[model samples]
Target: MLGDMILRAFRLTVRVSAVVQSSCQCPALHSCRALHSSPVLWAGHNKWSKVKDIKIPKDAARARMIAKYTMMIRIAVREGGANPEFNVALAQLLEQCRNKNLPKATIEGAIKGAKSKQGAQYLYEASGPGGCMLLIEVLTDNNTRSHQEIKRIMVKHGGALCEGARRNFDRKGVVAASRDGISSEKALELAIEAGAEDVQETEDEEEKPILQFICDITSMKAVRSALESLGVHTLSAGLEFVSHTPSLLNHAQLETASTLLEALNDCPDVVRVWDNIHAQNSQGN
Candidate 1:
């Protein structure tokens, strides 16, 4: 039902995001969040949003992939250094981008841009349809331009910039892992052993099952290490704004929320968008 309705948008907001914050109190960091209907409320997309992962053209997908990786690479360079050999994080990112088959020129260009001291990360908050809260993660060199653009996008899409949306969410650490051949019991066991508070199963665009482990933000790295030691293949480890209460949207609201997310993500500067929107269970109505 959702696939037919959600637009095919390009790259969007996620710092693994849409992770996370580095505690930069300076004019960076945007906020908004949730009330708690589910432990694992967001992971790339939630239950209702996942089915809407319809395919776009192969070229388009690759372009979007490249765009996302480009920003990620730039961020890594800005955080660490341009020299991947010295920056373990940058080296790992380069490997991941290579695995995605990002063009050599694109990778090189991102690295080159990082040396200019540009790339700053920010999050912007907005209220969407059904009053769903959204957090848009952005990576840009031009803060003023990006800010104005995001505000414009929000206004154009039935959304508006609003403060205090962050109250709805708890900033928690999230570790994504492979769910292949792993049962729920096994997932729980791993979560317990790794000191993760909870584990919820979701999927990628390809429908491959994924496990999202929730942990205290400070223990994020430790939890990931623990899981790896327990023989789990860790996909990515980062912080996320997990909602305490997910907003339940009616049909029209659901449709509008989907489009709003897509629109926010469409911005080239946007890294990823986090939200508290979930479809109202028809069974309950």
Candidate 2:
């Protein structure tokens, strides 16, 4: 779909290029000497603007995706090392990057940068709208600076730094698998057979269904292996601070909570922000 969209944009650009060239060949355009006036470059004044408008959103969305993937890859590299051949987490992440059509050059660049430096990891606990408890993860050389920036962003979004947020979360192993054609009953059965402590169903950024097989932090690789042997393609295997106490959010509260999350994630030093927010109408909230 992205390729087709780019092809369409290319065709439009080619058509516009011819129009621009024809204008450049005009005798009047060449003879014009007005200091305040410029020759018209295209058939429509908004043609270029329209092209930019068409391209910018796609590029921005793609950029956000790459940034997110880059962060994940960096964390994988930091935890497991840069060699995918020996790093199971990194290997799975690389496969996911390919599946999502991420550029090979971008992947390589991220891996290279990931090996350059290391930072102390920290977690910021906060409470947001709708009683949402947040665990904001940070990786930084300067803890004071990162803390100030995160606190500012949180406060700006009507949230504040808080204590006991970590108490609501438990670090556990998570193995994500595609939920295509997989029923709830089937997911439960898979979890049971794979020795997962629990299973949580969720959707990815693409709105595709996924099942997170949760287990002890040390059992991530084993559970992922079991899932794969059982014919379930694993998307990622990692440890996460899974929230145990969920906060139910109404429509307005949900909107505010989401905005707060976006703000938190935008901080460069912030790695991941886990929350215990569930919509009031869904997830038995």
Q: 135-239 in candidate 1: lDDT tens per residue?
A: 888998799999999998888778898998888888998888888799999999999999999898886433468999999988988999999999998877666
User: Per-residue lDDT of 141-213 in model 2, one digit per residue for the tens?
Assistant: 7999998999899888889999999999998988889887899999999999999989999976555788999
lDDT, candidates in the order shown: 0.78, 0.84
How close to the true structure is residue 86 of candidate 2, measured as C-alpha lDDT?
91
Candidate 2, after superposition: displacement of residue 148 in Å?
A: 2.6
- Cα miss at 50, model 2 (Å)? 9.9
Report how far residue 177 has shifted in candidate 1, in Å.
1.1
Q: Which residue runs does candidate 2 get wrong by more than 4 Å?
A: 1-58, 75-80, 85-89, 115-120, 281-285
TM-score of each: 0.67, 0.71
